[model samples]
Structure formats: structure tokens, C-alpha cells
Target: MEAFLAYTLVVAALCSYANSQLVPAIVTFGDSTVDVGNNDYLQTVFKANHPPYGQDFSNQEPTGRFCNGKLATDITAETLGFTTYAPAYLSPQASGKNLLVGANFASAGSGYDDSTAALSHVIPLSQQLQYFKEYQTKLASVAGSENASSIIKETLYLIGAGNSDFLQNYYINPFLNKHYTVDEYSSYLISIFSNFVKSLYGLGARRIGATSLAPTGCLPLARTIFGQHERGCVSSFNTDAQQFNKKINAAASQLQNQLPGLKIVIFDIFKPIYDLVANPKKYGFVEATKGCCGTGTVETTFVLCNQKSGTCSNATDLHHSKEASDHVSLKQFDVLRYQQAGRSRFLNDTDKAVNSHRLLNISKIPRRRNGYEHQENNSKFLQDGTMNIN
Candidate 1:
């Protein structure tokens, strides 16, 4: 599996370097919306640290991840050929050996603000970048400085964030509120992120992919908690998402112009996910409104999702263990607390759809040199962790 994953990474890197697709070594930043498990390291209570959260994952432990399965980062990594998970950079066991493999710096419940916007628990964008630096330094130390520098220069840097900034801080956050208006906030975030991207380039990141925020209004947590008893999603939230995405797209254009020779790209997570929600038929997804967990009651983010809790469906009643170390089999309910709450009736306007009116042309990107060429072309772009200093 590891070798297969590694091979996939090679291919994915080739494709991503093309600038039209995702690449290897996904370096993430942002909130629980995309956090892997940084919250597990922290003492904060705002986390998705329970079973059924990772029901689809191998270990099946909660581990503080904040998604039904893997988030967009995991899916992106899988496509790129990461043999297994992109290791958590902060994980003590990592010891920096996995630096070339890829790392996740995202924390659960985190946002653009120092304090969490909605859940009152999360790492801010600044901290996330700070951790990323630590990981890079550790890698430099382990890989004999020279090799580590080479690796960071060649590796693909992926960022998926900012929704928490808008939704939690600007829109619906209770404790930590927004200081700027939606337009001002979006500009502020993109501006900071623009500088942050330049910083990465300064630190030897030549390839980067920044994902725009998805439709927060359609997210289960947003729809339910901020609904004021309404079953459907809030429209204003989606509007914020659209505006934020437009800003990101614009910023990506500007950054690309500035970073010469570097392959910088933007992932349209908004369009893909929105399409899935709007026209489930286009994608193979059956449900998008709420997840298939809890008694259809908690939605897993706010409550436990356990089949043992009597909310699971009749199909696929298999058991798996909690921790990966112990291989003892447990009931399906014991691990994945997934429960089909039936098809969601609450949805955005089917008549007013983004995908229906839009035709996204497949953009082509230049594929970087494969591993062999990467080793050969170490001086031109992949030497001593130096970029944009050119």
C-alpha cells in the first residue's frame, strides 16, 4: 500500500506540476473545516475527537479529525499517490522522517482568528503557518540541511482555508466576532494570504495550490446551529462563500504574475462541492444536505455517531476496531456510528445552480520533472530551500 501510494504521488506530482491538477505533499493551513488532528495535541474541548468521525478511516479512532472521513486534503493526497496518510507534522512520532512524504498542519475547529469563530476552539491561520515553519525547520535538521532544502523546494504546497474566517469570525461566530464587514474581511484574508504565499515561496515552495472556500451555508453545522429553527441552510452564508471565492480567484491571478518560474494554481473546491450538492446526479453522491450519522440527530460534529446507538441502517453492518494498533474486531456500530437519516429534503434552489450556467474549461498545467529529473535539476530551482529570492 505504501509503495502504491508513493507511486501515485509521483503521478499526481506530474499532473499537479502541470498546474491544472493537485500534487503531492499537501501542506495544509486553516480551521476544523480542513484540520487533520492538531486539536488532538491541544487541550481544547472544541474538537471532533470521537468514533464514527473517522469511521471510514483505517484506525477508526476519533483522533480529533473533523470530517466524516478524510477532508478535501486527504482526497487530494489520495489522488496524488500518497501511499497512506500525509503524516501530521506536529505528531511527536513523526520525527521529521516523513518530511518528503508530506504533512498536515491543519487543526480541528481552527479558523483565521486566534479564537474559534463558531465552536470557540481552534488554531488561527497564524499558528498554523507557525507550525508549518517548525515542521520545515525540523525537516531541514533531519535531512542534513542540504537535502531538506531540496525537498521543500520540490514539494507541492497545498492550502485549503479561510471559510472559518468568514463563517465563524464574520458571519455566525458567537464568542469571537468579526471586526470587518464581509467585503473588507474577505479582502483582509486574501491580502494576508497573498503575503503568506510569498513567504512560502521565500522558504522554497515553488509549487502551490490554494483552495477557495466552499459553500459554508450548505455545511451541516452551519445549516443547523445558525438556522434559528429553520431546517434549510442560511442564504447569506452562501453569499459570503461566493464572494470569498471570487477574491481568492483574483488573488491567485496576481500571485501567479509575481511568482516567476513557479507553478502556482488554485483548486476550485467551491465549484466541485457546490455542484455535488446542487446536482447530486452529476456526481455519484446521494446525500449532501446532512451527513449520514447519528440518529440523524447529532450530525457527528455536535454528537456521537454510533450504529450501536440504534441510528444505523440495515446495510453494511460490519465491525472494526477503534485504534489501529489493536486488531480486535468490533461491531460496525462500535466504530462507524453512521446512520442514514434518509434523503435530505432541505436544499438550495435547484433552479438557480452554478454548474448549470457555467462551463469550466479544463485548464492544463506544466508537469514538473519526475523524481529522476527533480534530482537532476536540483540547482536551477531545488537548491538550499531558496525561492523568490531569485
Candidate 2:
């Protein structure tokens, strides 16, 4: 009987140790880049819960992720030693004990600006925050008040925005562009980003990370439409993205200075993703300017790339482009017949880097509370307790 009691105690101790996570919880907010499946429940066309989407994920099933496999955030979670992902806020799985692990409030086709999400009838950033608040209440009910307070305070919050603001809204919306210049629109978005962070801080979030925009001009669809005549990256669009990154960096610093205990960092995805696009050979990607689906030129969303759509024999070797602008306001094109297109890798190599903390640079970020400043080439933030805002 004594031996039996000892065995039970040992088992209980082991279980308790295993339950202790790196940061207690991970909360995410963003667009399709980090959206797991929130859009699946929404009546939006910006979903990826179909074939060829998750062809490389475990179980070979689409989980509404926009990637061929695990998203960057998914890999980040795994790196942090999480066995299960944070359930999407709208999914049925986000209940009971699952709330303790945290929740994903991202929706595909959403952005920093609510107008951007409205263009596609998707959940806006403001709505996602409201959902997060609801999740917090449910979490407190499940974990109790004191435990839930610790979880919310220590949770690593990640947010991604801005991509759809430019690609899906401002570029196409004449009214938006006519009212504000591109720089002015970017400033407006940054103001929104600032308020969003402040709101999260008010709700007990301390650590946050934001991701910078990828090389938008190099995306296959962007190249096809804007750079068709040149067969090169649209310098104008990339310049806009670079300018936006600069503004975000400045904004992050200002936020850190203002928010007493907040630890914020901007993950530099621009350089890493651009490296993959510019020097595909360095990363073993043969074609960087085209996608693996359909004609490899456009075809991003569901209506564009169905099972009938000709997909490359191996998506592992190819990249996927951003969503096609098939909004009802614009004239739509006839769906293309199946055609064998060349494959090129996207985010695959970067996932490995993220696991090792190589490409996730937190350069030029001022660590105010840490009493140090990040150099222009440091990746120290990954080891530290800074969360990313995308």
C-alpha cells in the first residue's frame, strides 16, 4: 500500500511538470498568415479548408491554414513546446480546458483597417479583439480567477496585419486611394496598430510581437498584374512595404516607451522572405516568381484553385501566392483549365529557421525595460520574452 501511494505521487508530479509550458499560453491575432481556421466558420471566400491546401500537413488534411503545411506561428508554438495548437476562437474546439492554452482570433482577408476586411465580408480586427475578450472570460471560468490572471499576464500575444490592407483594399479601392496617398494610408494603419496594442495592454497583455510585410511585389500574383510588362518585382509596391516596415519599427519603439511593462518586438520577415525570393538557389527553390497552383501566375483563393485546378505534382518545392482579387466589385475572369505548372518553395525553409531562431531577427528594437538595445543584426529577442505583432 505504501509503494502504491509512492507510485501515484510520482505519476502526479510528472504530469504536473509536463503541464508547465514555456510561457503558460500563446494568444494570436492577425490575418490569413496566422489564421488557423476562423474563416472556415465565416461565410467568406477567403478560406482554405479544401484539397491541396494542407497536402503537406500531418494527416494530409486541410485545417483552414493558408500554407501547404504548418504555419510559421504553428512552428513557433511547437518551438515553445506546445503539443496542441491554440484553437481558433470561432471553432467548436475552443471550449473548456482548451481555453487555457489560448485562442487564435485571426481571420483570412482581414487587416489593420476594418475597411479592408469589409471588402471581403470577413471578421475585422476589432471583432477579433472582442472575441479575445470573450475567450478571456471563458478562460477565467475554466481556470478560475487567480490562475487566469497569471495566464493572461504572461501569455505571449502575436499579431499580424497590413498585408491585406494594401493588397486587397487600398490598391483596388479608388475611393481609398483618392482620399489618401499611399504614405498617408500607411500612417493611418500604423495609428490603428498603435491603438490595437494599447488596447491589448489594457486587457493585461504584456508581451507582443508584430511581423513586417513580406516583399509584396515579389508575390506571384502581384508580379503577374503589376510587373507583367517588366517580368520583375514591382519596385513601387516593395518600396511601400519597406516604408511601412520602418514606420512599424518606430511605432514599436514608441509603444515600448509608453507602456510601462510592455515588451514588444517587430519580427523582420521582409529580409528572410526576400532572401528566399531573390536567391532561390540559396534555398533550393527553382522558381520564385510563380506559384505551384493553376497557371502559377494568379489563382489564390477557393474559387480560383479547386481540386480541378492543375496543381504542381510537388507543392513542397513551390510557393503559394497571395489571394486573387476576384471581388464582386471587379470583373472576374474565367477559371483556367488544368495545366502543369512549375513548383517553387515558400516559407518552408523559413520554418526551419524559426525553429532554430535564425531568421526571426529582432533588429534595431529598443529593449527599454531590459536596459539594452538590439543591434542591427541581433536575433536575441527570440530567446527573450518578446511577442510578435504581425
Candidate 3:
């Protein structure tokens, strides 16, 4: 018993040491999935800082996050041991120590393609990068040169964009459809993504995680516009999204090879969201077709999901379609585990801590399917720290 106790103490010390060595900060960029009210400061109609939108968030006050509650990034910051939320880079609240913890430059309706953002008067990717440069200068003044450099190098960068490019620009705009086929358009976006990652690396960002496009064809807006005749998801659009995801995955590999001493991981949000939509009953979701807000059919942005819109008792039902409602079924805890697992994998090797990083671990990372889906092997989806780090 004494020997066992001694071994346990040693293990505890090692664990604590590892926790202490975690990335010092988190910086985010992207569209609505990670946007925490940067649009509120902008003049675009894509804003979401109103009642009912934050009915479920802390203090039940809308702070510009697109969702009714905390965004995935908000939860991610807390999981990383951050006591305070990272304020929007454009907000007055984003000053002093908040800049140290990190800042969010994401804008709703923004995407890899500038035209998409321009259509809605949102900040473009190029402009967001400029803000990041400005952030570096501010950070250096506050934390001093060396401390700011350390913060930039050791920070976890989360980026999620590209959805608006397809949903708002490519699919709806006849001009783009006339100029480029879906395959050609995807390649064009990948090129932009490649440049973005390279630019971030040049700015001293070492650890980066970029999210792939979600199943947009499954969104309520898509269904309303393209699938109204069939009254279902637009299969062609979903197919395009899958193709884009595949191209981005390849791009990530290429970026890792080209940029030395840089770590980039592409998080696969498509599969988990697709699974929820495909098998809603397996995930305890009853209404998979519509969101809990307004009509849940075509509601998005300021026009829909507003204070006057009818909200469901449970926000988890905020999927965009009956068949696609599974997209929003992803629990906050599930996403947190996936991110933690990715961080653990990348940070596992202390010797190469500053030199190398790992991508997502596909084998052990489990999706948040319903009880029925895991009935056969309850242990498979368990959130234990045993997830394989590849």
C-alpha cells in the first residue's frame, strides 16, 4: 500500500506539471461558429446581439455570439484553464490582460473568399489578418517583447471559416456559378486557405487548428432555397461541402510539409455533424428538421432567430433541418473533449514541445451519438483520457 501511494504521488506530480505546461493562450478567427460579437461593432445586418439569442448564455444577455449560449470557442477557453473570456478584438472590452489571454477577430458572414464577406459588409480574411498584426503590436506593448513572443508562439489558434463562401456566395450568386464549377471553386478556396495558414506562421503562430466546412446543404436556409420542391436537404450542396473538406485536408498536409516548425491540424466537424443528422434518434434528438428558434426553416442572422421568434424549451434542438438538425446536436462537452484530446496529442511529447505538433486522433476520439448508437459498446464513446494521439 505504501509503495502504491508513492507511485500515485509521482504520477500526480507529472500530471500537474503537464497541465502547467499547456498553451498559455487561445486566439480565434473565423465566421459565426467562432464569432463572439465582432460583427456587433460592424454595420452589417449579420449581427446577433439581441434578446433570445443570449437567453441561454451567462446572465442571459446577448453578447453578439450567434448561438443562444456560449460558442464552442468560449467553452474551449474555459477548458484550457482560462478564467475570463477572450473578448472580440473590435470590442472595447478587448484590452489589457484580455489581450494576453487572446482576442477573437472572427466576423459573421466572413469566409476564405473576400467576395463572400463583401456581400454582407463583413470583415474579410485579409483585414482580419491585419487586425492580428495590430494585436501583436498591442500585445508587445502590454506583455513586453519577450513575453508577447512567448504568448504568440505557445498559443492555441482556432480558425473556422469557409461556410459563408459556399452558402452565401457560390451557391446563390449566378455570376460565380457561371464563372466556376463546384470543383474549380473548391480549389480556389483551398488556395486562399493555404496562403492564410502561411501568413499566420510568418506572424509567429506555431500551433493552429482549422475547422473544415460543415454540411451546409443540410442547413435550413439551404433547404428553404434549394430543396423547397423536395422539402429536404439539398444533396448537391452537401456533396460540394464534402469535396471541399477533402481538399482542405489535403491542403493541411501540404502546409505542414512546406512550413517547417509549424503545426496545423484540420478538425473534422463534418462527420460528427453528419452523423447527428443521419441518426437523430440515436442521439436523443426529436426534432431534427427545424431549429428551436423561429420557424427553424429559413431563420438565420438578424432576420431570423430573433427575440420575437419562437424558441424551443431546449436549445440543443437548434438544428437547421428535420434531417439536418443533427448538426446542432453536438454537445458542448463533446466538442470540449475532442479539443482537449487534440491538445493532449500535440503536447504529449515534452522533448519536441516547441518543435513538433500532432493532428487529430481519429481512432479513439468518439462522436456524440445517442445511447442507442453506443448501446453495443458503451466503453467505445467513454470520455476517458485514453483517446489515441496520432
Candidate 4:
């Protein structure tokens, strides 16, 4: 908890420079990675409103986030000095004054491809945009047209997609895989992403940040299904993710150049997450190949990782007694917490660059190279004790 607090403090301090929040509001759209609770309202099988899902969240109440506690975006909210999260757009909480701080239009299984969301009966990217338009009307009603316009122009827009496009759609859907090769599929997604950003720009958004795809093959579900006899991170899947990231990053740059007064940043989530997965011990985790809930091998969505599913114990405590050690079954959230802990290790320099320049325009920020590539050469803590951002 100390580490978490210290991490939070660093972020708070970064955004708190000049005695104000970085932006007036934050509007988010994407999949489960950023979905707060919109899936709870939807009649979809891809929900996370159950036990062990939000065990570390406030009041231990599941809020439809596919994790044990606050998401990285939740921490982003705190860092920006928002007293409350941008309420899920479909929730009752997203009305009146709540609309002023933006709304989360993300769904649990949605992605850049509308068909990806269709597979799970969740809201598609196009529908989420329609909801965003509706939200603008609501905001105008509450905050007035002029203030609403200002907020719309200044709000930090965030989008996290691509993961579901690959994991939930391409991998399983034979039709998709049969048609497009990896590069072709990624290019297709980039086209969708480009259009999405352009649509947002047209809707009065100026500043946007989109998350790059994580090392998808390293995910427990992927490891189980596709890791083959070697039982390791699938290099093919990771390569696909890297290629997609390259395309998206290029697409973001092109979009920025095409759209006047637009500032776009492709947040490099892949490297940090991959680093954590590769070197779990450096980030205070004992397990990296499985999730915390259920069998931890293949369970990810609602039914598989549900109330009946067995969760791993927090057995990696320093106490190391029989009681403590017996509980050792490391999982995803264990790594997530420590990933948060380790962010402070290198985020300081990165945050400084972002804070010093325009907060939203972080495209040119030169990040430190923490050596996950050479992790085997050193102990858990690198000689410099810094986490690298790729």
C-alpha cells in the first residue's frame, strides 16, 4: 500500500503542477481495459460484476472492471485530480453534473472492429460514438452550450482498443483469420482507428491519447491455448501485437499531421506491461503466466472467472511463514499491483517530460530504457533500480 500511495503521489504531483488539474475532463472509449461498468448495464456474457473482480476496489464491490482493483485509467483519474471517475455512460450515475467530468463509453468486449463487439453482444465502437454524441447533448443541457463546448475541446480523450480485436475476435473467428493475414488485419484495424480519431476530432476533440496493444500472447489465456508444447509466451502473437503498435503509432502521427491543432499520443502500454510479465519478480510478483481468479490458466471473462472460480491467495507476502507461503499462487492482479508500484521507478522522468511540455502531447517524450531484454543478467532490481518504458 505504501508503494501504491507513493506511486499515486508521484502522479498527483506531476499533474498538480501549477495548482490545477491537467484537463477539465477525460472522455474515454474502448474495451474492458478501460471499461469501468458499462458492461454491467448491458445484457452481455462479457461482464465482471462478481466476486474477486473488484476485491481490492472501494468497498470490495465489483464495478464491471476486469481486474481485482482500480484500472490504470482509474489511477489516471486520480492523478488528474478528479474527485470521482467519469461515470460509465450507461449507468444511472452518468447524468446531470456527472456529465461534466466526461463519461466512459467503453464496453467490456468491444474493439476497433464492430464485429468483434458483435461476437459478444456488447456495444460496438460505432455505437459508443453515438452515445458520446448523446453525452454531448446532456453536457450541453447541464453545463450550458458555451462551457460544454470549452469542456469538449479541452477534455482529454482516451481510447484503448486492439486487444479484443485480436484476442476475442481474430484468434477465435475462423472467418476473420482465414481472410486477412496478421499484417492485413492490423492494417484494417488501423483504418478503423484512424477513422475513430478523425470522428472524435470532428466532434470537437483536440487532445487524444490511445493505448498501444499489450503483449497479448503472454496473457494467461493465450499462453494456455496457443503456447504449444514449449508453454511459453507465443512469439507469433507478440509479433502481431508489435506490428499493430507500429501501425497505430504511425496512424496516430499521420492523423495529428492531417488534423490541425490536434495532439495525439499513443501511450506505450505494451512495453511496461510486457516488462512486468517478463520480469515479475522485479515488480514484486511471483506469478506472471496466469490470472488471479479461477484456475488462472484460461479463465478471463464472466463465467470462466466467476463466483464459483477459485482465486489465488496473496501468498507472496514478505512474512514467508507457513501460513503466508502456503497461499502462494501468483496471478495477473498480483503483477498489476506491483506494476503500479514500479511505475514510479521510471514514470517520474516520463511524467516530467509530459508535465513540462503539454500534458496531452507526449509523443516526443524520450523514455528511459529499463532492461527487460537483459533481465536474466541481473537480479530483480536492476543496478539503477529503474523500470524501463518502451
Best by lDDT: 4
* Number of colliding residue pairs in each model: 13, 17, 6, 1
* lDDT per residue as tens, model 3, 54-120: 7677788887877767666665566456788888999999888779889999988898877888998
By TM-score, who's the top model here? 3
lDDT minimum window of 10 residues, candidate 2: 334-343
lDDT of 3 at 135: 94
Query: Where does candidate 2 stray beyond 4 Å?
Result: 1-21, 299-304, 313-390
lDDT of each: 0.51, 0.65, 0.65, 0.66
Instruction: Evaluate candidate 3 by giving its C-alpha RMSD to the native, one decimal.
Output: 13.7
RMSD of candidate 4 to the truth, in angstroms, is 12.1
Stretches of candidate 3 above 4 Å error? Answer: 1-20, 298-303, 316-390
Q: Candidates' TM-scores?
A: 0.68, 0.76, 0.78, 0.77
Model 1 TM-score, all chains together: 0.68
Residue 237's lDDT within candidate 3 is: 85
Off by over 4 Å in 1: 1-24, 117-121, 173-179, 228-230, 295-390
Model 1, 1-390: lDDT tens digits are 111121222233334345534343556666554567777767676555665566656675565565444555554465555776666666765565666666777765555444443355556665666777788887878777888777777676766567666654556543323333567556656656666676676667877655566667766556656766675667888887778767766666665655655555553345444554577544333545554454343534333344354323211111111121011111111111211221111112211111111223333322222111112232322322211113
Better of 2 and 3 by TM-score: 3
lDDT of 4 by residue, 1-390 (tens): 111232233333333332444788878888876788999998888787887567767878877776667765676676577899999999999999988888999997899888889898999888898899899999999999999999999887878778878988899887778755778778767767776777787788876766677788877667777777465888899999988877776776666556666766564455656776688786566876665555565454432366766677631111001112111212222323534565344333333222223324334312222211122232322333221222
Looking at model 3, the pairs that clash are: 282-370, 283-370, 288-321, 288-322, 289-321, 289-322
